[model samples]
Target: MNPRSTATAHVDTFARDRLPPPDQWPDLRFDLPELRYPDRLNAAAELLEGGAGRPVFRTPSGDVWSYGELRARVDRLAHLLTRDLGVVPGNRVLLRGPTTPWLAACWLAVLKAGAIAVTVLAQQRPSELSRMCEIARVRHALCDIRCVDDLAEAGVPGLRITTYGGDGPDDLLRRPAPSTPYPAVDTAADDVALIAFTSGTTGRPKGCAHLHRDVLAIADTFSRHVLRPRADDLFAGSPPLGFTFGLGGLVIFPMRAGACSLLLERAGPRELLPAIAEHRVSVLFTAPTAYRAMLAAPGTYDLSSLRRCVSAGENLPAATWRAWYERTGLRLINGIGATELLHIFVSAADEQIRPGTTGVPVPGWQAEVQDAHGRPVPDGEPGLLAVRGPVGCRYLDDPRQREYVRGGWNITGDLYVRDPDGWFRYVARADDMIVSAGYNIAGPEVEEALLRHPDVVEAAVVGRPDARRGQVVVAFAVLKEGAERDAEALRAFVRAELAPYKCPREIVFRTALPRTATGKLQRFRLPGDGYAESSAREDAGSPTGRETGGDRQ
Candidate 1:
């Protein structure tokens, strides 16, 4: 079948089986026991053992490794780690590099060697790496040659470093490959399997530790209900392996299903599409922004093999979803996950997708909307979204853990509303909500409205401090090609569609809005370096006579 025809068939099947009614969605529940591994539980031995001769991973450089071959290489690497690198059980091993088959193998090897894997972003600077190493007490570091200098600059004491080939001493790459297969050491269900650093929007990064059971729980929950990858399916994506999103999509989910995967040395939209087309990749996982870019790319690429595409990291706008489906005939399944959760907690399977909402909580997890005082809020009322499942989050020596865990629920910083039928709709981060003249406004709602305009390509909403009114909504927008940017005209357009108070009080045009690596808009960085000065000027110029607007909008 042709690409376009196959795309149609896939979408039709998904629409019929997966698209649940917005109001008829079922509540999430965890009825199964938490997954506990035997002390000798190693993912490589568990998943890749029987498929020794089967093709497992294909790299862009035409390097194809079979399951048996990959396992053999992992054995050598694991032996070297323990014998030469002095790595021992419970030791924290820091891995910093781009996504590659070797990196994936290294991750499993770390776990096989009974060490806690701490994956750091390759793009992180010296200062960032140093702080994380100190916080995690990482003693061993492995990175690509490109990132070696930064690690050196970080000055981690007693840190043993190993560099991947493509640079550095060639002799180091010639270390004798160990032949003996490493035995799986006993690992407890609650023993730390991984330590992922949270994206610190509020303050310093916090290490969120996940147990061996958490890894299995994620696969049982989101992967079982949402993805359902088959053994023959090929999983591929753009998130760096260090990120939990990537860990689940590229490694744990596929391994759990005993499937193959393709790992790109560099993952971006440009690189990802070509890999998918070239390798006939079946499962695609990435953020919404990358999907939008793929839709906008000039050439037509064959994406016939893709049976599933998952979107996470940030909210998936309805417009992006419609555009992608219109082009590819596949609805991007939206999911919301955090480092604390280890994998996606809220998601829609191919059979139960809702366009704008973040979908229902995954089975085996309980989610509810609550007020500030931890009281359950009425249905349809926006409240703090809290979740609890087999995979409980434990922060390392952080007092804020108290604020996050109320009773047994982990309070995600997001504000959301649950419809009477059970679908959960994302509103805004509690800190991102703008209160203007007593009105509570969600920036994303305004941004979504703005995106509907043909001229707007991107938009970010932030609250500018005001003296008369506590805060006022201000919008930063990037115009589409050939579109004009007129602040007054844009404000008038918003007023026509939304309530007057919810409309932006001011609009500022920019080439692009600042965003985190995960594609979340960094509202704190919106005002730039002059933010303090701008706020001072606005406070001084505020009109003194207004107190009429109530918080009813």
Candidate 2:
């Protein structure tokens, strides 16, 4: 069967026409029976069915919304969008706000109403948001009442902005609703559902267009096969709904499993621990840095309720994984996923876990290590990680699509070494590889060595231009409070663990490492100074302060 889906329900056709030519698309397979969807499908409608009486979302304000209640809320919002806001099938709707039930509901409503959702983090500045809007040609927005300033400042011409979560007469939540039952838009399974924008090193936004079928495929493949959730489990996480990671772990995955999830607007490590025990959360999803911060914190959190914990966003050092296991008798499930592919395509759960290595691909996906020329590399050799599955990257109107999707494989740009036994160990991003005097050094290997130190709390390694060597390994570290900043001593510590050439000759200590709002390191933005910054970490590195979400797009 020709997998090309030619039929679409999009009336706007803007996003449809922008997709790369059919020849550039990655191979999409639906080997699993559950993955086969009807020609006409609505992802929100499929998920919101049959779990009426169970709690689906809970907030810190003691508000618990059941599946039935959430369905009503989404239907009402859908009605408002189509009836009052003039949204039609295939129109793009920008959703900007902190992570909350209202924001999640808005996302579902947009899909149900046959409108494409563009969910961006609240921390994104006006310029970043504007660029994404321009790229997606967004003409409508539903923003949180408190976060409207930036969207208003963006001032995209002809864009209609509606404020929600306020008492104003025009607010989405307060507006009178139509009493008629809102019928779900019967969209083709292959029709574009949302446009998620992810940035590359050049900071250029690439819009990934995902179909309605792709939404349920991630849940069926990863959540169903690996991070299996029970209907009675209570899920929680730190990634914002804008990120595919959070959207999967917190919303889509749970809803597909008939489970409940607690949505916290501020989900930093310090704030997350207490909320978990208070809410009796069973499954937790966050980054490796957050786990280390939680371990370093002084408080005695009642983490007995936590049954499963998943980590991503950065490589999980074996030391941190062991420490987390020692402190709490739970194994940290480490997985690597990309916004292009939606969620964690490679991960392990329960008995399938192996520390320091990302597990095998999920049930419906296939992964391999390939050289630059797209030829298969030998075992234990580092190469670009290529994956193809039920869902793949379809960058909207971007030339990079040819680079990302090569010969029917989605090249994730991550370097990995696949062992004979099929366990994939992450090396570093392909561009992040450092060549010092012709000796190739993966930044993550050096980072793991630094993280093994007793005083180092957070570490990032990058290459600096050197006169003699083309590039030299440089390490930026955030140490434990009151730890002495002795570059020589730290250097010696790393040399003891790694080869002398692979070790960082110079170390710069800092109070915290810089990260994106979605809690990812900005390696290119690393400062070259040896002095420590006075202020604490901005987003994720600090074990203190309140911040939320992963740079999840």
Candidate 3:
């Protein structure tokens, strides 16, 4: 199909037009000159081009699919999307499914066919899905058969939904393979390839548009420099492919190195431990919580084959790192990434890892601690974390773009301090700062303090409304098996480790803290007395709250 019509060109320009002015964009850097991408590029071609017979994906049941085999499947799906479904360049296609091999193929196929792939978490409800469709103006959908009813419930106008992975003859996997392969569509490097939605911990989900070049930039920088993967390395992770963390760790990184990945339908510690042993997986990507869970049953599985472990999606407590290293003799590679920037911009691997620090910026990226005026703060002073790199904030037609990309720096909503040695230590999310009785406290510092207690399994801290103090530190905790959930003991334990005002005035024990699909702690979900979004937005400009407008946007 000829996709070069003027109408098609206009349709594709929608995403590019929404980007902030060139003057506001971050200064993109590619240290390795070879990393400079061509103006006309397709991310799918870069990821799945030619490694002919190399194994690319392996199932838990021991089924292996080679790169050539996967590419053939992607070609057939691309033909189906373009020919049968009438998907055109720049049309937004919603992809809904778990991290299955077929779902992965479908994602690449959408990109290959010159459509924007909007991937949603498999567990997202109909309401969230509907809002996403409405916001993105999604034209078509490729959903797992189980999710079709919900997609239909979304009631998006003129939305054509196709089912995949079910018993129906029309299912994507069951459809007849195309007789002739469909070549990848030619797309500009700046063309919007994917629209990733944020976790929406605060309010509504905001879409972040990434270009074809941004896709390969992450692989070329982090995967090439820090991860240093081998062709035989088998990447495995717990995050859903919809999450950029998972997309980079499980798919792009491995593909860039000609390595394969083991896709788990479910990646809880119970499933992950056994699979690592059975598959002899070399690289593991997961959150800190999973590592703690895996420690509980370390004797039950043989994790001796694991050479590298990557932890992200949430703050990695020093205690979690120590416990994992003490148990496995492996230093966990800790990183901090965001949906706006596409993937990890700051991280440390192996000998460079500091127990509590998020390490230096990845090659080709620039990070610094800055104050309200976007000026760099002195080392060891807590301030807003700002970053800029090959990729930066480009929200899909949202005014929040101004707030996110101010003065050419992506002000991530994080509180961090860079030490004299250049390692950045995470304090808390800027919105998560707690103020009580005229003292400012970082919620994560208190969470870290609580985590130091032997009986505490999990902890999340937030500011609760107080009659006298305006707001007081409150904690929600998950206790170890058979441990007492006494609020006083927990408070006292934290008080000993931190200032008394920083300690949780009240600790409520829960079986589990609320978390996102990618295992990020959802502080907004913590119980608070009338901590309304309107009130928070009003205080977003306050200094003690440290909620800078740039950070929140």
lDDT of 1: 0.74
Tens-digit lDDT string for candidate 3 (500-537): 77877777777787666667766766657654442111
- Candidate number of the best TM-score: 2
* Stretches of model 3 off by over 4 angstroms after superposition: 1-12, 530-553
Q: What is the lDDT of residue 3 in candidate 1?
A: 8
What is the TM-score ranking, best to worst?
2, 3, 1
Question: Positional deviation of 374 in candidate 3, in angstroms?
Answer: 0.8
Q: List lDDT for all candidates, in order.
A: 0.74, 0.86, 0.82
Sort the candidates on lDDT, descending order: 2, 3, 1
Q: Choose 2 or 3, whichever is better by TM-score.
A: 2
* lDDT by residue (tens digit), candidate 2, 1-553: 2444657777998998998888999998788898887888989898888478999999988999999999999999999999899999999999999989999999999999999999998977787788888899999999999999999998788899999988889999998998665799989888899888785433567899998999999999999998888999899989888888899999998999999999999999988999998999999988888899999998798999988898888788899999999998999888988888998888888888999998899899999999989999999998998999999899999898998889899998888999999999999888778999999999989999999999999999988777688788888888899888778888889889989999885676677777755567667567532324332333233332221111232
lDDT of 1 by residue, 1-553 (tens): 0101111111112111221222221222347653434433444456556477777777888887888888887788888888887787777889887888878888888877767789988877787788777777787887777777888898999888887655444323457766988886566444566788875523567777665656778888889877888989999988878888888888888877878888886777888888889989999988877887687667879998898999987778898888888878887889888777788888886657888999998888888999999899999999998887767556655555666677667787888999999999999878788998999999988988887777878788888888877888888777777677677888888888799999987777777666555555556666622234421122212111211110000
Inter-residue clash pairs, candidate 2: 243-552, 518-550, 518-551
- Off by more than 4 A, model 1: 1-30, 33-40, 166-173, 528-553
Range of the 10 consecutive residues with the lowest summed lDDT in candidate 3: 536-545
